[model samples]
Target: MKSFHDKVAAITGAGSGMGRELAIELAKQGCHVAISDVNENGLAETVEQLKAYSVRVTAQSLDVANREAVYAWADQVVADHGKVNLVFNNAGVALGATLEGVSYEDFEWIMNINFWGVVYGSKAFLPHLRASGDGHVINTSSVFGLFAVPGNGCYNASKFAVRGFNECLRQELELTRAPVSLTSVHPGGIKTGIAQSARMTKSLEGVLAKDEKSAKDNFDKLFITTANRAALIILKAVQGNKRRVLVGPDAKLFDVMVRMLPAAHQRLVTSAARKQAARSGV
Candidate 1:
């Protein structure tokens, strides 16, 4: 648990960003990795990046939203690596739209990947983790999971669900005295492609942004940490057995804001958003 040497890890969304960084970092620590992502090119790129490390690495083109594929990948990780010690359910997507205007299809899509993917990964890897006798599950939630935002309803819903799910599972493991542990990661805008890859609906244009491009642009400006740094912080948390980790200074600030303001944080967020729109002349 304190070290990754010779341990095996399975990471979702290992194609790019934090997932990819985590894989590379873990490999540097001598951990064998089984990595999966929907993006074939990105997956291949990650595999290439890990070539510098001496650890065993396996790549699979996987859709975390597909329950069957996730379960199958879980088995494949065990099959390929002999045993899996960690599962990083880090695959996630973003949606920017008013809840009222968001299509059920969009809502379902984000939920499936962000929330249900964590559930499926946790369940699928748990037995393997138990068998390993030393295991951990790291679920990526978001700072949005800590507070609501107008144009991020779907993303917020999905992340909040992950937070709740990971918390309950962590507690259950403790109650059972299981050898496995869990950590919910809330990262605040680590520099990544998630913004450019996000689904930005027209509903946000007038309500929160001048246009979808500007919204994405604005979102990009919030990223204050590098994926490499985020990965290091996360691994440190896992080593310390933290049940929750907030990445970046912004994440820590947001956590304190919500803690101090609680219900009133909604008003503060709304006020900030309005001021931002005014400055951008939205």
Candidate 2:
């Protein structure tokens, strides 16, 4: 869609980070925004911030992992706004652990929100979006979706799944001749609280506490983009109807690297991860 004015966008994980930024930006562009997150306090803060813009804003506490809740929220959003033009399956969590070290519980926790949440959001909002006849689904994958990191197997898996799912969803939309479009987003380390805010499994806790300095140093090197800038790029990509949007230079470079030299890229990533672990004394 070339314009967002008067359009209604439903966003998951809208309390903070890219989601919050998206809400504010869309509201500024005169679009009505329905923001949802499990963090009620954060959702309240987002609502307060969005008040400056003269647009309709709705906030709800949501746990995207809950399928019923997600579906209900989708219905409620359409009921509240009369139509839904965009659905941003942006709810996600970060988990870091080697495949061997990660627990099934932790893995499931991440998957519910990261992978299954996308599924729920897409399916729940799809019918309404089609009925609206002006719809787009924006699924948030990560640069980790493009490349695997040794200590972040859980995160990597979920993101990769999201990427694949959204791609297929896009193709299906095309076949049906639906006005709905799908876009997969791969964002490089934007300065979000994900590092400090993500749920930690025992394995992740061990690494973070024992090697906090090294972890911080490594992240400092990789985190190069801000959430606001990432949101701007994402909005532009949506307007341009891009099938895949890479947010940051790091994401773009890694996307190319994986496509051109998958094996070599894997080796490079492995080496770098090992070096970081060694430096961290982990």
Candidate 3:
């Protein structure tokens, strides 16, 4: 995967955010792209933006959580593009609720999109990737995967599952000397609509914020990196065939903090949460 020129990439969540930027950047590098999202309008807009580049582009209105749809899309991407070399399993959602208070419905909703979506995309695209002779799967996890925090346990669980799943996938690839590779992406907050779109329940109001609005705001404040910058970092990691990539400075810092103080880092997170709660007059 040293070169992206003339490569074909299939991306989930390309309707916006890092997924959109990754498609644009790959197109700039002369890669043909097949992008999909549940957001049909956003996919159309992304297709329009990609027109500036002289590369084949196709868009699919897809729900990655649906295994049948994901498998069908993978076949169609190969059908339209002839061959596919990369797959970015980037579709995800967030839920803000305490682990104790979060309903099975909300937990299942996030897991279906955040964790199972990655599983579906990876499993569906892998055979095609192997056929292409040069293949890579990029599964987006999160900094929360590295360390747990209060109030959003389900989000952390989803990310942690992705982290574990990809780690195993990468090892199996190496052990068998598979032509396909995997990159587990642990992104710190980037400026994305995920926070705004995140479902915040009353369970998180007094616990993490004074209200749901401030909870979303608090999530936004952690977005210290731009989506474009994060996308660039991820592309570089994929080019390097890295097993794991950290997106932002905060992610890198958190990586080290967890490594050096694996057990005690929760204390730091607890302190920060208290400060945040105080500021919100919670």
Candidate 4:
């Protein structure tokens, strides 16, 4: 954990965003990377970019939701790289919908990837990581995981589950004195395609935006951090073995606000959501 040099890292969702940035940075530090994503083209592009570094890089097309696929991929990483030192369960998606408006299908889609994916990745690679002697697991949560938002019920549920799961895992690891450690990452908005790619409720078609592109543009404007900066913070957290990491200033502020206000914070969030809903004519 102290040094990434010559260590092997298996990263999910390495096709873009923070995952891609993490892969690039780790490669720069001489870490061999086994990167996977559902987007084959993006994964190939990431592999191409990783070639600039003098480290071995492998790309695989994977959907982290599939438990068998995740387990198989873990085996393949060890098969290809000899040993794995880090597992980054970074694959996630977004959904924009009220709890009542969100379909069971949409709920399952987000939960499968955003929450269950982390569980699969962690459970799948844990033994391999332990075998490596010095290993770490990093799971990505979000600012929404700390504070609920009206239209983000599905996403909030998934991320909050991830936070809880990783927290318990950290505690169990501590109790067992396991060689492996875990970190729960809570990132504020960053420049990523998650919002653009999010599945929005049809009920908000008129209220939010005329089209998905406009909604994405609105979201882009709100993003306060770059993916690379977030990646750097995550890597530092891994080195420091932090139990919880807030990737951006906004995330850190939100964490403190939630802790300080608690019940008052819920009222503030509800008020903001009402205002937004009113503006959207919802």
What TM-score would you give candidate 4 relative to the actual structure?
0.96
| Alpha-carbon shift of residue 233 in model 1 (angstroms) | 0.2
Q: Candidate order by lDDT, highest to lowest?
A: 3, 1, 4, 2
- State candidate 3's TM-score: 0.99
TM-score, per-candidate, Cα-based: 0.99, 0.95, 0.99, 0.96
* Candidate 2, 86-179: lDDT as tens digits: 9999988887666887788999999999999999999999999999989999999999988888778899999999999999999999999998
Clashing pairs in 3: none
Residue 204, model 3, lDDT: 80
Please give the RMSD to the true structure for each candidate, in Å. Answer: 0.7, 1.7, 0.7, 1.6
> Taking the tens digit of each residue's C-alpha lDDT, what string does model 1 give over 1-282?
899999999999999999999999999999999999999999999999999999999999998888898999899999898999999999999998999999999999999999999999999999999999999999999999998888899999999999999899999999999999999999998999999999999888877889988899888999999999999999999999999999999999999999999899899899999987776668
- Minimal lDDT window, size 10, model 2: 204-213
Q: What lDDT score goes with residue 62 in model 2? A: 94
Better of 3 and 4 by lDDT: 3
- Candidate 4 local lDDT, 81-152, one digit each (tens): 999999999999988776877789999999999999999999999999999999899999999889887667
Name the regions of candidate 2 deviating beyond 4 angstroms.
202-209, 212-217
Candidate 3 per-residue lDDT over residues 48-160, each given as its tens digit: 99999999999999998899999999999999999999999999998999998899999999999999999999999999999999999999999999899888899999999
Q: What C-alpha lDDT values do all the predictions have?
A: 0.94, 0.88, 0.95, 0.90
Question: How many clashes show up per model?
Answer: 0, 0, 0, 0
